[model samples]
Target chain A: MGAAKVSADHPGIDELFALLAYGEVAAFYRLTEEARMAPDLNGRINMALMAAAEMGHFELVSDALEQRGMHVQQAMAKYRSVLESYHAQTIPSTWEEALVKTYIGDALAADFYLEIAEGLPDEIADVVRGVLAETGHSQFVVEEIRAAVAASDQQRSRLALWARRLLGEAITQAQYVMAERDELVDLVLSGTNGLGQLTEFFEKVQRTHADRMAELGLA
Target chain B: MGAAKVSADHPGIDELFALLAYGEVAAFYRLTEEARMAPDLNGRINMALMAAAEMGHFELVSDALEQRGMHVQQAMAKYRSVLESYHAQTIPSTWEEALVKTYIGDALAADFYLEIAEGLPDEIADVVRGVLAETGHSQFVVEEIRAAVAASDQQRSRLALWARRLLGEAITQAQYVMAERDELVDLVLSGTNGLGQLTEFFEKVQRTHADRMAELGLA
Candidate 1:
């Protein structure tokens, strides 16, 4: 509806949605692989459910792009490399690491999107909310992490370090995107407090990540 | 209702659900991997949707077992090897082969279940129907196959032969299951025509397979 504003100073909704759509697709693939590596049946099933939810989120963002008459493939193509690079750099070698990676990465991504959602039009923000709401696997991850750490104190420190590594990689990727796409940064910051919000957004994301780590007994 | 019938002369409903549950779990994993092999984003997304549906079916059958006081994991453990062997023997090397495997395998499995459903009690049969009804990804597969064939005749023959290989493997696995679980085979065949329906069931499965092959221009 407000195409002019979207084009001029706002974060390009198409670009942001495209980035998120591809991210979800990549996550779905990685999570499904992680599900296969799960040590037990229920763990496998839980991860599969999470992977399914990611696909659902991808569909949501893809549909949003389509409603705006953007080609799904073309919109998604540009953002593919950044997300794939992130996944490649942070490949989880174990089920525990996979859980931590999914938990921290997903939580951080959700927070960033929520921040961006605040600046978006009501309809687009609604789509963001729909994508953000599918946290069904969060509790499952928390349970698995705690149970894992409970079995060995070594696992606790190992996973805590892993979480830190994941957060580092995530922040690196986020900064890479922001550096590369000034439009996305503007879209993200313009609604709340402009450039000043960047510090506040990272702080908020860090707080949530720490809270999630605590929930997983890594705090 | 009819616990005696279930225990004495008939295949236990628990065994049936257990078999179906494991099969769905196995399919979810295989399909998820197949989704990754998809050459394009849309194909990947479509396969992920089908994989998700399989997970949903797994949950449905798992829940049914739980409601009957059966341990879901325990119930599923018995049927694991047969399904695993089927998947192990038929790993698809390419995206087209994956599609053919999924399309033909899913259709055959659905037909077999439908035939078996006729002998089940109403409630259990309803569960079977619910699982059988999730062919939502069928049209997506058909479109992809036709598009591939129209683009290259070489792809058509390669896929057609792959479909035949998949069918042979499926029959081999089905026979293995029948040989291993006489109760399951009995459960499968005892419904409609008592013990005389084996030939008729295979004929039905073959007919549907032909129709699907024709739809893909492989017949």
Candidate 2:
């Protein structure tokens, strides 16, 4: 899991690249899907821009994976079923729900990638960092959520619940991903001293999630 | 009606811009949705590229609408429902159906825009041309549909029927759009000599659609 094990054929490094590649492309599509749920064309267009950003990252990471001789499809295949089922189980029912899901989901994935960046090779970490740089909340997203929450108490409570549910679902999916992929588990474990640090790492992530929710007035 | 009528307040110009803006963004989302149904991640990523192209046009047309001193929302408002219902009614039932629909639907739109480009002011026509230029069938899409059709007689027939249904539904929706929007009728009419040319215009457009289908082996 350390930079010493960051070669293309190394177990966890490939999995990490595969995971991020699929994750970026998947996010691109998911954001486009959610854009339709936006209240208006402007909202939808803004979401489209965000989706386009994800597409850029997708190309970058997929290109990096290809440079490693890993076919993008072959790399993505292993995680496809798990990610599909996770998305199926956590379908957002409304525009606000979808917005929150994308926000939290992106942040969580970014956090995971950043956490593992320590174990990745220099170039790989740089590419991963480049992808995460765009994962922060867009201004329009914050304003939209804040304005919606300000307009209605029901929206506030409902969105707060949605945020919490997103956290739980994301954790469940992440844990499932870690458990299901032995290479990923090894990659992650190799980086950490023990399970205690990993548990703390997640708690730290949740704290950041709560802070983000607070920023949107959904805390 | 003519270049002389190309102003910010013109009736159909706004509608045209609005319709196009919405159409491009809608295609962006729809293509992203369809990308998921692709047989593999590589296919999905290719669809994403096509979707991204639509997003670029969406931005161009949308920016043009804004420069008209018309709010994009207001410009696109009249189209929101009609396009929504059009999509609602013409929803593609499968990946092949979606592929054919996008391929055919985009070609039809490019034809219409090119047909009407003569009546537009030079600048507006230039913008319209820029957007339509990308409307030509992408090579990958042609290859994909052709491969599918070549693989099986059932796919050939199935996609042929889908193409035909797309043409029908497209005509139905265009008629609805024409009848419901008084300005578009006036706009289309003012650009031409009489009802005869308009009917001829549609027939010509349909001819091109057939040609595109043949190119995909779905004719």
Candidate 3:
């Protein structure tokens, strides 16, 4: 639709879509799996809804990959281990922890995507922008975490520790990803026209994450 | 949109929606949970997408219940144990088994809902019919099961046996429900103009099940 996607010529763009697509599908899996940890039926339903929203985004990006003449599965397979490892290493232990992971993990991904979206071609950028828009279920996670934190000092401190762990795990994985995927690293840096250096870009992301932690009153 | 649903005045209608809504949410949970057993990424994604479709139907019936002035949680709570027990008792041990349970469980529920859909008030019946329509994911299940069965006699025999077990377990719970919920029994019987006796009703359902088994080449 947007210039017929010269995607095959752009390994970086395909990597971008595949990264986004697999991230979404993996999120769908993690959220639904973690729904088991929910303290109540309402909590379980919220996680399931959140998972479904991620699948909705997966479908969008998946279509883009297919239209670009890439096999969705193969493209996604390139990063399955890494992405799944990210979720595996950070399996949320409590309902509050799961909420924190969902909130922080998703916010961090959005910030990273927006960071690189501008460097991609128009078609790829549009697809990225379209699916990155919030599905609004994140607000439920935020409110639930805020309420839980407000309940007790023990709870607040526990989640604060959990959030920092999530952030650390995410940064570790992001660093691993950039080191491994040359195209992705190139794609990310090219979008840094508003930025001066790669360090500044990551600094902005970290600042936003800090703001999110504060919003949850965890900071 | 359809007559604004005079749902509060009709406890039977609320029961119907509650049963359907809880049924959907449970299915959403089960399918996603079972997606863990999927043989490949494709299988997992298929199950996840199927689960998401169930959630979509859940939202429809859930919104319907909320509009009827019923608390969705309280109403759904009525059947939580019974439904959860159904899934807990029949945890599929293999990917093929997961596929079998998914295919059979969903089809059986659909047939039962359609069986009672006719005698309900037009509005409730319409909602039932609307959501009852297959989201088309079943074809994937059927195809997968058939392919697995075609490859080996062991798979064919195992799934056939497993399918009967699912049927028996489902019938036990369903009979228990009819005995417990007077409103549900009355609503079901009310729809029996085309149906002669309750036994005949179940006989028809069984015939359909047999037909489905034949379609799967399992019978």
What would the DockQ be for model 2? 0.49
**TM-scores vs. true structure, each candidate:** 0.91, 0.82, 0.93
lDDT of 1 by residue, B1-219 (tens): 122122322545777788889998899889887776877877877888788788778778888788888899988989889899888998888888888888888888888887777777777888888876765777888888888888988999999888888778887887787788877876765565544567777777778888889998887
RMSD of each: 3.6, 3.9, 3.7
lDDT tens digits by residue: candidate 2, B1-219: 333434435578878888888778777777877676787666788888778778778778878888887798777767777766766777887887878877888888788877776676678878888776773337778888899989999999988988887788778888898898888787777665558878988999888988888999987
The TM-score each candidate achieves on chain A is 0.92, 0.92, 0.92
Compare candidates 2 and 3 on TM-score and give the better one.
Answer: 3
lDDT (10s digit) by residue, model 3, range B1-219: 112223335577788889888898899888887887777899988988888888888889999989888899899989988898899989999999999898888888887887777556677777898777788878988888889899999999999999999988888888888888988776666566433657777787788889899888798
| A4 Cα displacement, candidate 1 (Å) | 16
- The per-residue C-alpha lDDT of model 1 at residue B7 equals 30
Give me the runs in candidate 2 sitting further than 4 Å from their true place.
A1-11, A28-49, A135-137, A151-158, A185-200, B1-11, B32-48, B133-137, B151-158, B180-200
Worst 10 residues of 1 chain B by lDDT: B1-10
Interface RMSDs of the predictions, in order, are 1.3, 1.6, 0.8
The 10-residue segment with the lowest total lDDT in model 3 chain A: A1-10
Give the alpha carbon lDDT tens digit for every residue of A1-219 in model 3: 112223335678788889899999989888887888887899888888888888888989999989989999999998998898899999888888988999899989998887677556677778898778787888888888889889989999999988888888888888898899988776666556433657877888889988999999898
Top candidate when judged by lDDT against the true structure? 3
Instruction: State what share of the real interface contacts each candidate retains.
Output: 0.65, 0.61, 0.74
